[model samples]
Target chain A: DVKVTQSSRYLVKRTGEKVFLECVQDMDHENMFWYRQDPGLGLRLIYFSYDVKMKEKGDIPEGYSVSREKKERFSLILESASTNQTSMYLCASTTAPTGRNTIYFGEGSWLTVV
Target chain B: AQSVTQPDIHITVSEGASLELRCNYSYGATPYLFWYVQSPGQGLQLLLKYFSGDTLVQGIKGFEAEFKRSQSSFNLRKPSVHWSDAAEYFCAVGEAGGGNKLTFGTGTQLKVEL
Candidate 1:
């Protein structure tokens, strides 16, 4: 089965602290994405990488950055975490770009900023 | 720009009852539509997608969706509901030409009463 793994399930950080969420996929997908899920607001994309070191901003990319040094790994970085950034972070990957390509997601990492 | 809208915010139905989740989208031409579900403390899972050809599409876990070009809607349906089906369902739309970016709706929270 295609597996997407998020190293952290729960994390708590103080204000202005640096936060890193790691995601890895075994399927060697070419596209990877990071999104934050909040009540009423839903899941908004932060950043996406189509290839190694190539990133693009999504709808809500402002307080976050992403890294894709390798094909299997994608990392979300918050240079200085704020309370507003506290939410469930999800990482997804798709094998290729197609009309019917299915995106697979990890278990998600829940972050709490205090 | 392509966008998706899910009218229902929350829905409650007894187990073994029928379910229908509404999803509407605004796009210039034919858009790639998808339905995803996120369980409690879990990431998103692709339930189904509709690109072209058949208007009715069958998905995993006994879920199906129908795309109506006249109404610009892709609604998900299930004949019977289970307690485990309780989750947040999101409708999304993407550009037609093999693009990786997708705009997601606010999502509908499904509650199955046992």
Candidate 2:
């Protein structure tokens, strides 16, 4: 079974504070993604990395950045945490590069930005 | 542009009752459809997926989904609902070669009554 692990399960941060949400996958999948889930809004993509050091913006990428220094790790960075940034963050990974593949998700990290 | 719509926001069913969840999508190319379930505070898990071939696909946990090209819909169904089946169900669609970028629906929160 593939496992995707997030570093933090819950967090609280003040306004304008920087925050980091780390995720790691054991499947060695080539694609990694970051998403934030809010009530009634569902899950919206924040950023995705298809390869190491390569990142792309998703539907909701404002105030968020991502890094993929290694194949197993993808980190989501909140430049300046705000109350609006409080959400349940999820990380996912897939093996397909050209064709479609099933994505596996981490447990998720809960953020509370004040 | 690819998009997914789940008409139902919340659904409640008694244990042992039948279950069905509606999902619709808009995609240009051959659509890859998927149904995912997320427990409270947890990441989403793949319930089933439909890429091609058989319209009806079986997934984990006695869940199945059928794909209808004419209607552009993929609906999930279960023979009988259980208490553990209470969770948020999301419908998603992916492009043919879009790096597995998936567009998810707002999700339907299912509540099972014992």
Candidate 3:
């Protein structure tokens, strides 16, 4: 079975602080994604990496950046954490260009900015 | 641009009762539809997906979804609800062309009563 693991299950940060959320996948999928889920807002994509060092902005990319230095790891960076930035962050991975391929996700990181 | 919509914000069902969750999409060409479930503080998991061929797709945990092209809808259903079935369900539509980006719905929260 494919498994995606996140670095932190829960985190707390003060305002203006920087935060990092990490994700790793054992399946070696080519595509990885970062998303923030909010009530009534669904899962909005923040960033995605298709290959190592290649990144693309999703619908909601403001105040967030991503790193993909290796094929198995993807990291989400919050430039400046704010109270509004508190959310449940999810990481997902899948094979490229295949519509039939299903995306697998990590357990998610719950961030609380105070 | 492709988008998805899940009409119900929350639904409650007694154990052993039938379940159905609605999803609608707006896309130009044939759309790839998917249903995902997320437990509290967890990432999304693929329940089922519809790419082509058969309209009805079966997923894990006794869940199934049917794609209706004429209505542009993909609704998820379960024969009987269980206590463990309580979770947030999301519907997504995949972009057809080059990249593998998925647009998701707001999600529906399911509450199963024992």
Candidate 4:
């Protein structure tokens, strides 16, 4: 079984504060992704990295950025947390870029900005 | 650009009743369809996926989905609903060589009545 681990399960941050959501996967998958999930809107891709040090912006990458320093680790950074940024963040990974491969997700990080 | 739409926002079903969740997608070519379930505060888990071949795909946890090319739809179904089946379900579409980028629908929240 593949394991994608999100470091923080729950967090509460004040407005204008910087926040970091960390994710680590055990399978050493080549592709990693960060997504924001909210009620009604479902899951929107924020950022994804196909290789270490390589990142691409997704549909909703406005206030977020991601870093992939190693193959097993991907991190999502919120430059300035706001009330609207309070939502659930998920990290996912998959082997290479193929339609047949399955993408595995970490539990999730619940961020609350007040 | 590929997109997905889950028409139903919320659905309620009694235990032992049949279940069906709708998912429609828009893509230029043959799309990679997937069904995912998310328990509260948890990440998304793959229920099933359709790449090619058989239109009907069986998944874990007694769930299955069928791909209808004519309708551009991939709907999930379960023979019997259980209390544990109550959760948010998301439908997603991915491009074949699009670097695993997926467009997801605004999930459908399921409520199972005992």
Each candidate's number of clashing pairs is 0, 0, 0, 0
Name the 10 consecutive residues with the lowest summed lDDT in model 4 chain A.
A94-103
Q: What clash pairs does model 1 have? A: none
Tens-digit lDDT string for candidate 3 (B50-113):
8889999999999999999999999999999999999999999997765578999999999999
Off by over 4 Å in 1: none
TM-scores of the candidates, chain A only: 0.97, 0.96, 0.97, 0.97
Candidate number that wins on lDDT, 1 or 3? 1
**lDDT (tens digit, per residue) of candidate 4 on A48-91:** 99999999999999999888889999999999999999998999
Q: What TM-score would you give candidate 1 relative to the actual structure?
A: 0.97
Q: Please list all clashing residue pairs in model 4, or write none if there are none.
A: none
Model 1, B1-114: lDDT tens per residue? 888899999999999999999999999989899999998889889999988899999999999999999999999999999999999999988778777788889999999999
State the local distance difference test value for candidate 3.
Answer: 0.92
Docking quality tier of model 4: medium
lDDT per residue as tens, model 1, A1-114: 999999999999999999999999999899999989899988898999999999999889998989999999999999999999989999999866834588899999999999
RMSD of each: 1.1, 1.1, 1.1, 1.0
For model 3, the stretches where C-alpha displacement exceeds 4 angstroms are none
